[model samples]
Target: MDKNNLTPVEKNKSPLILSIVVGIVLILFLAGGLAYAFSTNLITMPFNKAIELLVPEISATANPDSSSIVTITNPNSTGTIYYTIDGSDPLTNSLKYETPITINSTTTLKATVIDEKDNKSDISTQQFTIMEKTVEKAVETVVPENSSSIIIPEEYQGTWHSIKATGTYNFSGNTYTYSSGGNVHSGTIGKIEPYGNSSTILVFYPIEVNHGFTVDPGEKGDGMIKIDGTTYAVENSDVFD
Candidate 1:
């Protein structure tokens, strides 16, 4: 074989060399494609599972005053809280908890936690019982002189019940009875002081049997009477009568 001319054996070796080079190039291309897919997280085979989302924590309380608001919280979980008041499970499209939820009546609350990745947590449920504040008339009592400076309104001279089961308040003449949670607190109206132009404060003192106890009926708001921490609203009156 001449220096410039390849022998038959040498010609065959050239094809082999080219074949090896092509195989190596193909392998490199396949490797690069796999790396790209892995970097982009497009390949599902490498990951066994995704990180699970944390379940939401819920807190709520029933209010006796019928003005109680519920506060739902999710601790250690960073995400939006979805809730439902109808006792159904919470969904992504459910009402979002932007502020504390104000429930005017009895309700069964459900909530769920959703993370930024759209992972949902287990559902949480809670029930709150609200008492119906109904006003009923109690047996009447005679008014005592010098007990109060203001004339007792007939609208207030009745028995009242808190809708939330907070308790009951009976206003008859110069005395009133407030019972709650199996505990009774009775007092006599010492005086009726002016509050706002539309409301008054019913100053009360414990009876002789329970003397030394001071009971202050805070400023009456609207048509509701508040004794201590409990609030009582008059039930519906006889419309026909």
Candidate 2:
């Protein structure tokens, strides 16, 4: 009577033999977890998944055109390229933008991704400019050939520091004011009597200093120089004879 109570019919057969050893250890742990989930295809077992994750697209280039060189392609998923150079939105130190970005003026571009379940994308963008557009050329002033005797444009004769009106000129006497010389401005000059060609005061200052244009001079003189009606000419006097 003291074997305590191991006598309830042997304690109901010891819990029915421990419920058949926990049902055979839960069927060998569900058949060893479905045979390690079908011999390991790397487990996504709920259905099936994986169809193009993403992370691979960037480009740029340059030379005198400032600079830029960002490239990435065919990347399936392995992020580490957050950028923002005016087109904000990319935080994680935000300058992990790799490249040779050397632009001079306007710029705005962005790209971000972190994927791998840590997922953080959605900031991709593109804009560009690196300052290098030079095309300004239309300066062709070349009329030099001054000998000082006054007459000009015989393709112009040398010793030109001459600039009329503003740099103020007096010609012939060596009182050419405009200090800085060379091409148009800072005191540019050229006015061999073109005050709107003012009727030439009706010539004859010795043919207005030797045929200063607009003259017929003689022998039926068809050379012509009409004023009020405006007409000018000079076909002789060897231009400065």
Candidate 3:
């Protein structure tokens, strides 16, 4: 056969073709290794982790009974928040901030946060004041009923002109007689003048036995006033301090 008319059989054994085939195999092996590394998603993290080490945000609330609730919000999405209250930072194992407080008085509410990467956040505090309790007062008192010997606490027997007793009077107790809201009160002192049961139109003897009365501030009728609400027996005479 002429050299110029190369045959297909000669070309099939060419060294150049073999070399190209070897190169392709090596390239494929390298490419596969690169793909495996990407699939595992390993090398891309630490760099990402570095950015996440930043701090987080925290919020807090307090209740009336001296308790508080701490809420930690993690904006990084890639990290979580760990926090503490007890007036301490996240570096300690102190109580985790949760639940509301029953702050009877003024109190301080605090919160802190930390990410999974040990990133520390600033501490936050809130001051709160609790509502105070109200006291009930007794301004006036009712008189006693069915009493013969009427002795009054000298402190109570005062000349009182109250438009309070207008209707039929109803009173209880044997120690004292007084009136409230248009009701006559009879006590150990028998009956109090002016507000006492209708007696012979005459002057009252021993004006000393009459218990006194005081109108409460900002009240129309006699207010619930008494010496701590305990019944005081007619002192047979003048009741001193």
**What are the Cα lDDT values of the candidates?**
0.67, 0.47, 0.44
Candidate 3 on 92-171: residue-level lDDT in tens? 45445344334345555555455556655555555555666675553334334443543443333433322332222122
Residue 54 local lDDT, model 3? 43
Cα-based lDDT at residue 153, candidate 3: 36
Which stretches of candidate 2 lie above 4 Å from their native place? 1-8, 11-15, 18-20, 27-93, 96-108, 113-117, 130-140, 144-170, 173-241
Mind giving the per-residue lDDT tens digits that candidate 1 earns over 163-212? Answer: 56678888787677878899997766644444323234433443344223
Model 2 TM-score, 2 decimals:
0.29
Let me know the TM-score candidate 1 reaches against the reference structure. Answer: 0.41
Best to worst by TM-score, what's the order? 1, 3, 2
After TM-score superposition, the amount by which residue 63's alpha carbon in candidate 1 deviates from its true location, in angstroms, is: 2.2
- TM-scores for candidates 1 onward, in order: 0.41, 0.29, 0.33
Cα shift from native, residue 61, model 3 (Å): 12
Indicate the worst ten consecutive residues by lDDT in candidate 1: 207-216
lDDT tens digits by residue: candidate 2, 55-166: 4366776555566655544355466666777877876777775554554566776767654455565666777766667876534333223323344322122222211211
Best by TM-score: 1
lDDT, model 2, position 139: 44
Off by over 4 Å in 3: 1-13, 45-52, 56-155, 164-175, 179-185, 188-241
